[model samples]
Target: MSRLRTPASPAYLRVVRASAWYDLAVTAGFATPWTYALVHDALSSCGNALGLGALPELDLWQILFANLMGSVVVVWAVLRIVGPLPEHGLFDGIARALFATWQAYALAHGVSQLLWLFFGVEVTFGVLQLVPWRRGGNACRARMRNADHRSTGRSLT
Candidate 1:
């Protein structure tokens, strides 16, 4: 009996689309507090209240800087996801690694234990992004091999 099978979309595309959604969520989460003084102060106070220690006091410039950085991440993530380029995944993976590492270091030293949740999410998603990328690369290689065999009049099997 033959089994019915539907071809799956490329793994990298699925990953990138998911990543875009995640990035938008992160942007919304970060942008609000960084943009508003009341929210910013509340968040900073919450950190200290949670025994994570006091967050840095942000002046207007610092607040803008933080918001700007968050905006950049949002834009970059959107571009990569919309375009779904192979190299873009690698680039985002590397950036996410650095962000996760920094967050982990800070949490370990008690800089902000509250950020542990952020670190976990970032690390998890970052690794997830890379997994599909590698699979996609292998799939490409296999396709190339099959094509070469066909060109040489050899049976693909």
Candidate 2:
């Protein structure tokens, strides 16, 4: 079947939906504590919430820097959702993998049991994003190949 269609097509919409979920998660869930840590001198609780071992006292500048990092994630998510770049999925996958890896490291070191939840979600969603993109890309490529075959009466294969 032809993969060519408008953005409203099921496959394209699926990608957009997944991207939206990821962006929302980052914007709402991940950025909240960082914003709070910046607004208040509560870095310790933020660190604890992430299952990180006791964090050293954060200076005012450090808190600001942490919030800045959070802001970056928010901005990146927004841009990718609006633009919907093909490479965005790969970058998101990498980011989720890194988060999962860090959580696993923390769990192994006995940093906190709470990390397991984060780890599970990160790994699952990260892989889930990869699957849809792969399938979509494959379908598009197959359509292109079939088109070419029809035009030339010869298979590209």
The candidate scoring highest on lDDT is 1
**Candidate 1, 28-103: lDDT as tens digits:** 4445443455555666788878876666776777677667766787788778667765556656777889989888
Q: Give residue 89's error in model 2 in angstroms.
A: 1.8
TM-score of each: 0.65, 0.54
Point out where model 2 deviates above 4 Å. Answer: 1-34, 38-65, 133-157
Clashing residue pairs in candidate 2, if any? none
Q: RMSD of candidate 2 to the true fold?
A: 7.4
TM-score of 2: 0.54
Q: After superposition, how far is residue 116 of candidate 1 from its true place, in Å?
A: 0.6
Error of 1 at 83 (Å): 3.4
lDDT on C-alpha atoms for all candidate structures: 0.65, 0.59
Per-candidate clashes come to: 0, 0
Residue 56 lDDT in candidate 2: 51
